[model samples]
Target chain A: MYRALKTKPWISLLAFAAPALVFYVIFLLIPTLGGVYYSFTDWNGLFRSYHFVGFSNYVEAFTEDSRFIYSLFYTLKYVLAIVILQNVIGLGLAVLVESRMRTKALFRTLFFMPNMFSVYISTLMWTFIFSTAFPQLAEKTLLHFLDQPWLGSSSMAFVSILLVSVWQGAGYLMVIYIAALQGVPRDLQEAATIDGATPFRKFLHITLPMIMPAITICAFLTLNGSFKIFEVVYALTGGGPGYSTEVIAFNIYQEGFARDMRYGYATAKAMILFLIILVITVTQVAVLKKKEVEA
Target chain B: MRKRSLIPSSLIVLLLIIVTIFFMFPIVLAVVNSLKSQGEMFKSVIAWPKALQWENYKYVLTEVHILRSLYNTFIITILSIVGIIFCGALAGYKLSRTPGKVSAFIFFLFLSSMLIPFYSIMFSLIQVASGLHIQGSVYRLPLIYIGLGVNFAIFLYHGFVKSIPRELEESAQMDGCGQLKTFTRIIFPLLLPITMTIVILDILWVWNDFMLPLIMITDYKSYTLVLLASTFFSEYSTEWSYILSILVLTSLPVILVYLVFQKYIVQGIADGAIKG
Candidate 1:
């Protein structure tokens, strides 16, 4: 029977995984290796001749690169703001819909609607609302104070991106949290209520604890997405107002293709960004998994 | 205590209303602006149109080759979805069943790519793409779509496949069905919900994708809807009525699909991102 067992699990696994494996290796893994290799050389994106200059790319990017630091700081600011706002508002919307309310589906659709639009187009739509419609409305409504150069001003541009990001994302996150809220077992809520638990107390004791896993997931997504944001910022402002809105992705994009070629250096900056994200994502996922267990 | 709780509730309501108003602002403005004529647009941006210009949408649909662009988007999106579902489901099926370090390692590599900011290697990928002899033709978009899409598809497929019992697959194999047949006949049907999720998610994404189409496909006539709309904005940035109409037209396909796969999308999103 043992000799008759001619099946090979490894071969089957290899066969099963081949399509994804081949595509991944060609498109993703190959490019990643190419990135690491090119980071050492000063290859003009369009040129053929290249000489390796090890560690120089990374060293210069860290110490001599002013825009790199600015990009880092700018991205961190956007990440901090978007990470908090997207989650708070999303969680709020989720809790509201979970309250056995009327028009739940309607609200869900309205909220989730923006995620369906392409971010670039959504940014364009917001650009109209900001530069055209909002200003257009500011003339008639008593809310004359609402109009401004939302995409133009260096300061207010932050708020403009933040508003669009939250509008586009919060609803999707709300739907995510809504699912977790439903899974919370109504009996626990009822038990807390029977024990003379106030709404706040019951929520603090039962609801919050139970939804920590959802919170972790939402926070992770928001954080991951916000730091690497490019499309919305590109569409909304194009990192204008003296490039004050420039984040790391846009900066890398400009260095790579949007302007004069710096493919090697651009890849270096990209690598740093990747390492930073990889570290944070791993740490957050690990810590959150632990908290999910402990809670 | 009850009053304090009520206060927080009202505060949350206020916050939500403010956010909702901001969220709905663009859609409302698009609808109203799409109703206005060119004269109406410049005369008073806030003023109501004397008569609705329903012709704006008609113009976008017919003259702009909005229908053609929609066909192109539909082709790319559907192909990408089929590719994603096949490769994702196949890899997911084996990875979940086979308990091995190699399989687990491959899964982690795929998952980690999701974290790497796409911009990191996006330029190089485009270079490789453009270097391909057929890259200039409309052929390259599907390759790009598959390249970017598989990461998330694998994520969704892996999660759902784990929940499916492996005994079902083993039992089917005992009856002498080939792996491919077992997949199509047995596992594939069982994966309907997750398939729905992958299809809808991919549709929603690839249909609306603009930046890729913008950079990769230089041929103006062969553009996707989102790319067409963006280029339209770039050329006639001041054409408020036309732009608004195009926006409405562009959003329809996605909203239609969303209506059909409503539960799958909402639930899959929850399972994939929110619930972990």
Candidate 2:
């Protein structure tokens, strides 16, 4: 056996790859294929038998299921908000922190601290702030506007979710942006200053182009991440104010696990999410990669 | 000239300071209010506690069995990381070294799976886990995480392996070192930098992950810190002080780890983002 293995490269490959492949097949690969297969079927999880029902699950999700449709639109709104705001604020904070000489590390640490906690933990913390702290702060201070029903009202709940997400997520993108900012050539910035390029102009022409790759990366990260938004909604609002704040992942969870054990139906919704993410991310990366090359 | 520049710089500093306060306020509020009595917290959430209520922490520690959750989390995280590194490094190294259509196709299979979001696979994965009787066991969840995580780890390792020259492995083989021996003895040690990057990323992920454990681990004894804290939060929803304490306590471990590994964690994120 040893002599045979020594001579045959395929044997060596099998030996090395078997451990990972076995587990991967059992857990990830099979499940992925199983999900796609189940999406076309009509098996409630309790039933052993399921019949193939092609595209009906998909059709129902888009046309028949209003809650799921609401969640789809809600998630898109969230992804758009998060992708734009997270990148902008992240880049802004990265620039600010990078500009400082003495306090760069301190500011970065402070800004990135919230990310160290779980989103659920952060949401719980913010829940306290929105519910209890803000109300009291409003009463005590002159800032009476702080007393709004942050999670109670539908519109405000969306804003509250967005706020908590950006607070937790932006720091991650900042770290990426900061790394990108460091790679920008110092001489170019100094030359811009010598040529009397205003700070804004320098950033627009010089700094922004240099960090296009980072922007692409940050955009991808936020887009991918916010689409899968679950814990924040799960903890903060529970898709509250009448499912107004429900996200795609949460909707799927509700359909599959919590409310209905309509495994086939939920699996269809999950596949829809996967396709949506795949299309959007591919488009984003393609556009950004083009921008990166041109820059 | 100096004075002219100083004004804008001071304004920038002020702006940064205000933003920093906003970023830190939730954590500071949680910490401060966690130390206050319920009535005091109600009266003034911003005010410092007149007397520090150590009992909140004591109550959570003693009554809530948070330490058990912490231990369970530690075990699962460590095991998952170890399993991922082991499986990932072996396959990644071998695949990168091997030259064939088979190797290329296998690598593609792993890489493409990364695009399949967890929500998509999760329902089926739960079914698989139950079919195999792998669910609800703290020991077995790491096996699932290994499955989910190895692809990314293999990606990182596959990329990193290209930087290492083939001569080292060639010479080891020439010196009568077996394939497994060469990997364990020589190649694995050289793979430390990327390994550190993987370790940092995986630790953060597996430690704080709430969803998988929530679905998998039904028994209270097997609850991860995040799951337990969330359960505790809902059970005592109106007890602000206690909930705040639980939040702070749950986060304390990760915070300490982050501070200790701050530089590496940042480097890991940058590396993972760029390469990934």
- Which one is best on TM-score? 2
Model 1 chain A: which ten-residue window has the lowest total lDDT?
Answer: A1-10
User: What are the per-residue Cα lDDT tens digits for candidate 1 across B1-276?
Assistant: 222232355665676577567678787777778899988876666667789999888877766888778888888887888888888899887787778898889888888788767766666777677676435355456766776778788777777777778788778777777777788898989988777777777777788776677767777767888888888888878787988898888887777767776767787777666414
Question: lDDT tens digits, residues A1-295, model 2?
Answer: 2463366887788889999999899999999999999999987877789899999999998899999998999999999988999999999889888877689988988888888898888999999999899888888999899988899999999999999998998889999999999998988888777877777888889889999998998898898889999999999999998888999999998888888689899999999999999999999999999999999
lDDT of 1 by residue, A79-161 (tens): 98998899888987887766535557767777887888888878888888888777767777777887788877989999998
Give the per-residue lDDT of model 2 (tens digit) for B1-276.
Answer: 111121268778988988898899999999999999999998888888999999988898887888889899999999999999999999999999999998999999999998788988888898899998888888889999999999999999999999999999888888888899999999999999899999998998999998899889988889999999889888999899999999989899999988888888888888889877
User: Any residue pairs clashing in model 1, and if so which?
Assistant: none
Clashes of each: 0, 0
Docking class of 2: medium
Candidate 1 B-chain TM-score: 0.87
